[model samples]
Target chain A: MKKLNFGIISYAHPHALRYASTIAQSRRAKLCAISGDGANSDVAKGEAKKYGAKFYKNYEDLLKNKNVEAVYIAIETYRHKEVAIRAAEEGKHILLEKPIALTLEDADEVIKAAEKNDVKLMLPFNPRFTEPLIKAKGMIKAGEIGALEYIHAISENVKPPIFLQGLDMSWFLDINKSGGGGFMDTAPHGIDSLLWLTKSVPKKVFADIGAKIYGFPVDDIGTAVLEFKNGILAVLTAGWGNPKGYSYGLEIKYYLVGREGFLDVRTAYPDFTVYQDRAEKIYWDRPDVRGIVGSFVTAVLKDKDVPISGEDAKKNLAIILAAYESSRKGKVVHIDL
Target chain B: MKELKIGVVGCGNIFNLAHKPALKNIESIKVIACADIDGERAREGAKAFNAKAFQSLDEFLDLDFDVVEVLTPTYAHAEIAIKALKAGKHVIVEKPIALTTEEAEKMVQTAEKEELKLFVGHVRRFDKRWVQMKDVIRKRNILPMHIRKREVQNLPFPAHYWYWDENKSGGVALDLGVHVTDFLRWFFESEPLEVLGTGKAIKEEAKSNDTFDHFIMVVKFEGGKTGIAEVSWAYPYPSRYGVFYHHVDIIGKNGRIRYTPLDTPVVGVAKANFEMPRFSPLLSTFPDAFERELRHFFECIKKDIEPKVTAEDALIALEIAEKAKESARKGEVVRL
Candidate 1:
């Protein structure tokens, strides 16, 4: 298999390293070059060196590399727009992290730029590709659980020390930088899972949320009840409330109620759990990161649909954004998507 | 020790399983008399507990008793409770203090006027694990809790009990949702601000309307804390998993507590199809929740103290539940 070359945009985000590492591990995907933020260039350089990828001071310079066939937009939430648009415009296949952009308009720009450049865009919703959830998807489709009537998903984290490596408490707390609070940050995985399992978009969203934990400008805990097209209801809870050291060690768990059967996916404790002293490390077993990036490579190489599309990311983001709007307006906001 | 003679109205499953067993366990409380619309059921319950059997509510109310346990189908809760309260009898109506907010208020006012205790049977509060969970939540800065009450009655039940009635029993939301709704309020010690919900009625060959099999509700509490709950009676082929169960996850700023029946300590191997969790630790000894609740009820009556779940508390839960129905119907958020 001819390895498709991959490039990293920024290492400022937490999942940036995991995505870069996945590219490095893939048999069909090679980590080609990296672009680090101007302020945090050294961290990206170290990350590139550790992963055996060349570092580029300018993102555009990295995009100009013919070996960089695909770019993974692991930048901060706010810069998702500019970076994704530029990458898509460069005709490079894009695998962006969740929250494709800060706003729907920016998401639209990314979509348009990708279409104009005729590139496949994939969002690395890694958990969805986990072995258990893939089986769950097959169950729903195979009618093992019949029609999905309701789904309750939770993805909360206490921000393990590893997650806060180069970042501080205020880094993700700033609305200007992160766009939203705990729910927005932790909710994407659950939101995407609900969207994918049911294979339906939300019709309305009613979110009861607050910034109670950190008392920051953004909400730290919340639940968004999404009503999908066929009277299906899903409750998505994503927060930074569950402390790192807890009995229920994993921060992510999903439960689905269907007409024929029931399905539960504990993302944090997805596969297994282990205890070492006071810290209970939950190995929410997932496919190798390469499986996600490799899917992107396979999609680009075969001219097939990516595992996670920009449209799917847009819908999930819309559900979450509507949740925020509902929280602020104190009402159930209808989802046009 | 003075014994409080308790008269029971409406001979139902909860009366036989929950109250009778628990009240019988306590020494200070004696089951004196029982009444039901059906004379045979009343006779059956009264005989086992060494209590007298009355033919009707009026006859039962005419007798002397300190308290009355209204175990009728939920539709009759307010009516029976109001009559018992006006007669100067303490009321322990089963969960869902009343069918509507108005009835709940009337019951509350009547109890206040009569200077009698009105305890609503939100029995899950008595679960030692749940009590411990709430205590931990209070001591810790718990953020949000997700509760699920899934009854694997997925294959259409015969609708034998009044609970299957859409109009009177209030389906799964009011019947089951009320428990967690009250628990959430008790846990937060706050009033509800808003409620948004969505539910579905499973299609089956039945009378009137299909049983409301599924419901997902979210409630906003006063102190920025929130609760999300899903109550369902439908999840077909339940034996493929296990029996009915209640699960809860309490997420906090530092830690979390999860009670899942499926997360059993032991695992059981079955047919080649799959392996299922053997038995939930909580469900293994499920009667304790009701036993503790009944003990608390007896203690409150004897000590002349207010119960944890007051009529007002149940009223608030019902209020939120009612709004949830409205939210589901209106396809919009309903403020409490």
Candidate 2:
């Protein structure tokens, strides 16, 4: 079988190294090249050297390399559209990092570009690949939890050390680059998961986004209440400025209140447990689910539909953008997409 | 016409703490009978309060009582309160009104049809500290209110006692939450427009499926002012020997008023010379606010006026509680 050649566009994203490492370990794909600028380029080169892959200083050069059939765009949020469009134009399949683009127009541009080139465009939302979440979706589909009524998702860090260091990241701290801070960053995963499992789009969103702490230019904490088209309501909270040295955990609790009973999945830090009628019956430990890279490779080799598509990714981004607009305008924003 | 006869239900921790002492203190109220699912509990309560022991609800209702105190497991609050009201008895039910909003509404309807006073035991409303705080807020017109209540789990009861079950107790928010919700409604003088909350069950082997030991809720009222209520059973450390310390701060158009019972100082005289010294009270557990609530219920019955904590008030608090739980469950704001 011909190995799928994969390269990364930038190492600035925290997940970039993981993508590089996953490619290095995967049997279906080979790490082809890495592209970045200055310090990021050096880091990417060092990572490439460690992984025995080529490193390119400019993203354009990496895109032009015929050996790299697919490019994973892990650049800054602002650069996603330009790199994704360029990669698509160069006939390379693209796996773009979340917040598909900072603006709806840029997201639309990337979508148009991918469609125009007839190449695959995947948005990496690794949580979908986690075994427990997979099991949860299956249970919901099989009527294990019955009709889904409510979903409560929480992503919390005991306190990350990042807040102790002054909030000084340019892209992260700026509203223009990051779109919004915590909501734009962590919430998209939950939003996409809700949409995926429920197979529904949000009808309306009410959000409260602001810097509750860590007085930064961008909102470090965000809470959103969404009313889905199916009458299912979801609440999502994201915070970046927790106390230092605390374990980071993501929990999604689905309250599937059925005609007969209820099914709940409480996804703790490392394990996800399913409760049938309030009695926990199944437990899956899925610490090894490398959701981002796993899905990217699965799409390339297995021809499986990418768990997160460009349109789905854009919808999540639109929800976040709507949240921002709601917070600023102090009114509920009707989600059109 | 005759002294209002009352039957005490569920002679458990709250009965011992509040009901026995308060009933002993109040005039025009007689503890005619006592009942508990546990015979020993009924006997203990009867012995403590100098009342007759009735082993079951049937026997308790047979007694000539004008009011029944529904203090059993939260799940039974609705059923028993409705039965008592239908049997021509005023009902003073415990907080959380009922396990679910549907049940609470039914209880309210039964009470209204029977022309009986359905007083929800939101003792915090009658607590000396909370009463003083409410008085200040009402007089000062505090617009935006922030109230927080914290408690370290000294001894957690068995989870089977309805309070721990999400379906029965409505989780921690409904258990300890009704107090804060009722407080906000009373303070704001309006129903909650919306509620957003987050909660989690921390104990690994917790018997009850309701997981959250900590809960935080943000309630928006009709007039644009927001009230935040934080309740937790997972306090990490011990404090000044008080069972629970409640702090409330009401932010208004003019000024902010902060109140904590811990701040109240006790005056004492020294034996040495004639020196008067000020020392804070040890903050012992006062009698349950249940007694005051019950007394108010009796007074309202005599005066032909509505009780302060009416069925509607209880229903409103229960509505807020349910919305907060929904918010915690869905991770979204529930609009009332």
Candidate 3:
């Protein structure tokens, strides 16, 4: 199979570097171009150079490049809709970093642009790529853990100064740009993870959003209590200001208590540790651990739906947006999607 | 002197605490073999204790051993113990024998058929304070009892470790809650009639294998006796103090007893007239309790008297833990 040529439009998102590196190392994709604003373009250019790719000062220039068949948007949350629309218009496939957009309208705009252009749009919810998470989803689907009763999924980052800086990004801090703060920035991962693991969409959501810390204009902490279609209750808490020096961590715990027994899949981190309740030794050191970039490349090359598809990603965004709306209204919001 | 052959399965944090220390103390129990899917961890465990390591349970089970400690995660308790029992070896399993009542029944049945002694290590049952408390409860008609176990420290291991995995460790209820559950069931002498619980994970960026670090469970026993057990892995306190230190309250028909076992001693001189708060006497009953349980296991193997805390009993505790989790999830009363 021909290696698909790819371009990254922004290097400002902390995950941009990882996305770039992952694309560079992909067996099925080639790093072709990078585009970003003036201040970050230099760094993006340098990063692109390391990958032996061309760097463009503008999104149009990158899109015009004939070699770039697909564009991976790692820009600030606000730029997602505009850049994604432009990429889709140019007949390029897109792997958009999460949130899809700040609002339901903007998210729909991007989705529509992809539909209009007839291009595959992928939203990279990275947690779905982690082996433990994938295995947990499989187990739940296979009924290995029995019928799902409850899911408590949490992802907390050590609120280090560096991560706080990511939140401090003008666009990230602005509700108009970032949609909301930590809830919009990070909670989608948890939402997507729960939905994927349970294979159930939330029917109603009761959420509380506030600036527990960071003292930013937007909420840095939010909790969403979701009722899924299968009568499963899920609680997801996403926050910043966790002690730093730790990578982005996520835990998806499912309780499938039935007549026979219960099964638990405790994933400690993205990298290692898949624990069962009764096992003595934690299954650690997963060398073939799949991350989002690999999954994207494989999905595009294999013509398979990305483990977290654009639709799935949008549904998760709807849940987050609904959570925000519920928090704002101080009542339970029924999820339409 | 020939070393006592010992094989351990389940390479988790508990192995380091229970089996590791116990084996180091007993020169006779030579840890000859170890098994874990994490080959490196199994090797490290074997290296730490000077034993051979195997990545698969089959290979580990093939080895000749007088005793096998099933340290694998809690979900595998029934399968591993039953296999070890059928293999005709004395088995020591970690708490809450299985994830459900039926699984525990199968284990007991297998142990009975094989004529092997099965020891469920409710380690706190081996704690001195608990032993004293058990003695007290045995003698009195205790009413409402409260036991709180907290694990607030940043877990020494990642949340993805098997025990934190709901499938492996059965969440906080089966993993950590089971200890207090077993203690409560043994103390109350009755199966829980109903359970109510609630739990939430405070950390959002925690790993995928993690669950709610905070769990509060209220259990009502058959005879109008009720107990509450609250446990957490991310409670923001020191881990050792949370596990080793406990505040217990027993309200009886006649009198009430409040004790904080493993309390930090306060020593200071008063400038004028100051009264010292009375301190509970330092009780070093752990060694006795450990020796008693171990001797009982050995005796059960020889004399064939029913084990003190049978696998069936541990299963009952697990059933309570499961019901508590169900109640927590559903936010409704779970009738056991």
True contacts kept of 3: 0.00
The regions of model 2 sitting more than 4 angstroms off are: A38-41, A157-170, A248-291, A301-304, B1-93, B96-120, B123-336
Give fnat (model 1).
0.42
- CA lDDT, every model vs. true structure: 0.75, 0.68, 0.66
Give the alpha carbon lDDT tens digit for every residue of B1-336 in model 2: 678888988887667766777888888878888999999999988886688998878878877878898877788898899889888888887777888889989988887788777888777777777788678766766544333333223124555555566666667777777777888888777768888776645443232554776566777776545566656554321222224535464544333455543331121111123222222222223565656777887898878897667778878888888888887677556888
Give the TM-score of chain B in candidate 2. 0.86
Model 1 chain A lDDT-worst window of ten = A160-169
The TM-score values for the models, in the order shown, are 0.90, 0.59, 0.50
Candidate 1 regions exceeding 4 Å error are A160-162, A167-170, A247-250, A268-277, A280-288, B139-157, B203-211, B237-242, B264-285
Model 3 stretches astray by more than 4 angstroms:
A164-170, A245-291, A302-304, B1-336
- Global CA lDDT of candidate 3, please? 0.66
Give DockQ for candidates 1 onward, in order.
0.41, 0.04, 0.02
Taking the tens digit of each residue's C-alpha lDDT, what string does model 1 give over A1-337? 7889889897767677678776787788888799986335677889888988888987889988888899987777888888888888888989887788889888889888998999998887666776666767777787766777777787777753334546433546678877887787888888888777777788888887777765567777777878788768777777776666665544566676766556766543344557576555544434646578778888999999987788888887888888899989988787887
TM-score of chain A of each: 0.91, 0.87, 0.86
What is the per-residue lDDT of model 3 for residues A11-100, given as tens digits with 9 covering 90 to 100?
Answer: 766567767776787777888888875235667878877888888888889999988888888787788888899999999989998888
| lDDT for model 1 | 0.75
Q: Is candidate 1 or candidate 2 better by lDDT?
A: 1
Greater-lDDT candidate between 1 and 3 = 1
